[model samples]
Target chain A: GAGVSQTPSNKVTEKGKYVELRCDPISGHTALYWYRQSLGQGPEFLIYFQGTGAADDSGLPNDRFFAVRPEGSVSTLKIQRTERGDSAVYLCASSFGLGADTQYFGPGTRLTVL
Target chain B: TQLLEQSPQFLSIQEGENLTVYCNSSSVFSSLQWYRQEPGEGPVLLVTVVTGGEVKKLKRLTFQFGDARKDSSLHITAAQPGDTGLYLCAGALRSNDYKLSFGAGTTVTVRA
Candidate 1:
């Protein structure tokens, strides 16, 4: 793909509902990342993947938020018992090979929890 | 945890005016990047600074990385109405972790 892609551009769920967001990184990119952005704020790091495994999950807000990249090409972010506070734009990015390189971003999925 | 702080959460200026946005941090970074975002779209990369005290120019924009690598600034000369958007600064952790910490961002609205 020419750039990173995200699925379900917008999502609306009730409180306590579960939701899944998908991310497809650019071809040949070996690094992927997930970020969450609240209104009027910058994107906040959520997790990072180097390959099939997650390299860093420390940024996840809590256990309620989980992300996985089983094949290293596409990733999914799962949120359980969604809260109103979780309403924000979930962003995904990918870099050629990682290691502090520039990252290309996707359009992002806007998740609204009502 | 490394944190980047951007000043003037919101800025509005007239066309032909000049402005500078600042990004400050307490921790040094291996590299820093600047981005511009518009409504309903993802952020687009503007420039990246790797070496300390380095400056890069892109047309009417000038980006500078502080000597300490903990701060950066973006200066725009003779801004135009098209420059109205959100300006963001993100940093690459110095530990080679590949994690990017982004500043809160500065919303600039350049009016004609």
Candidate 2:
């Protein structure tokens, strides 16, 4: 009955540093997704994983962004050489499996690249 | 790239008033969803409509999907102060079931 959750609710790092955001999906959820939300904007898709494999990463803004769901139930979003422009709220969501299923969200991790 | 545009990006109204928010896109989607998010929290799914021209209701909230599957609308009746928050529309493209394209969102503030 637990909902999705993200760790390090807030992170602040230097522009040239690296940061990793973590997500814990609902129990038994086979699909997970990562998204980024800028202030006053809706969340933008980043990547999706189905059973530990990234099914789609097209939404990733660039090579600096990467995500992995190694065990299928948990995921990590990694940002390399972060830029000040990369500052935003990183959101994670998960679903039971496919198509029409509702993707529940996590509280999100706010990353500030100083 | 699919884009969902939400109109009247900001709305403020008194309690007990009725309001409607719209989401439109040029690209057709297989399904569309509405979510409500408050400050310091993640979005919570309100409803999902998969069939063209489909309509679903959640208590005081009503949602409609366009016949062409390219748009949707959310209407709230007799809204209360508790109804205030950000309304977001997300669409799942025909090409990918796992990915969602979200609108910029409409921020609603219902005053008592």
Candidate 3:
């Protein structure tokens, strides 16, 4: 079976720019999540979607970060006016359902804000 | 916010040696999960422990949740070079919680 897949494995942008990272979850998955990982640190939660609606978004650092999964299959993480502090690896994961289900992760997209 | 603390941020050991990584916290969780990640890749799930004081074994790897559910440990016996990677522990505050609190992680290097 195909696992989760993320596009633009690596992206480099200047500060104050905008960037979008894409994630393709496994077929039939109903839950999706996004996380950020800084160097030498573990991944921190960003946002989560259950079906087409975001079920939990408290982890989003600020209003500048937004995500959408209108069809409940694919998700896109958008960052506005990126800052050097925003540079990190953005990861996407999915599960058959929420709660205690094993999450399958994509390789991730490395975003560098210079 | 609940925080998970992992000990020995970096560890290097010879092949065939045993190593253990610990994850501790001040808050109790309904479930704990272990994951292994390699350079340039997202984390891969290793095991999940839901019961306090429960122990699960995957070949040479053993995972144990603390009696209070506020800590966990991963022990690998006679490790091989293939076992080298970053180990992470995450916890769900409630049974239905979708978000996970994760530890900084332990980087284990096995020298062959």
Root-mean-square deviation of each candidate, in angstroms? 1.4, 1.5, 1.0
- Per-residue lDDT, model 3, residue B47, is 96
Where model 1 places Cα greater than 4 Å from the true spot, the runs are none
- Model 3 chain A: worst 10 consecutive residues (lDDT sum): A98-107
Model 1: docking quality category: medium
lDDT of 2 by residue, A1-114 (tens): 499999999999999999999999999999898999999889998888889899889989999998987777889999999999999999999999875578999999999999
lDDT of 3 at B111: 97
Name the candidate that leads on DockQ: 3
* Candidate 2's TM-score on the B chain: 0.96
- Span of ten consecutive residues with least summed lDDT in model 2 chain A: A94-103
Candidate 2 Cα errors over 4 Å, as ranges: none
lDDT of 1 by residue, A6-54 (tens): 9989999999999999999999999999999999889998999999899
Q: Each predicted complex: what DockQ?
A: 0.74, 0.67, 0.89
Q: Taking the tens digit of each residue's C-alpha lDDT, what string does model 1 give over B3-93?
A: 9999989999999999999999998888999999998778999999999999999999999999999999999999999999999999987
Q: Write the per-residue lDDT of candidate 2 for residues B32-66, one digit (tens) a residue.
A: 98999998789999998989999999999999999
User: Chain A alone, TM-score for each of the models?
Assistant: 0.98, 0.97, 0.98
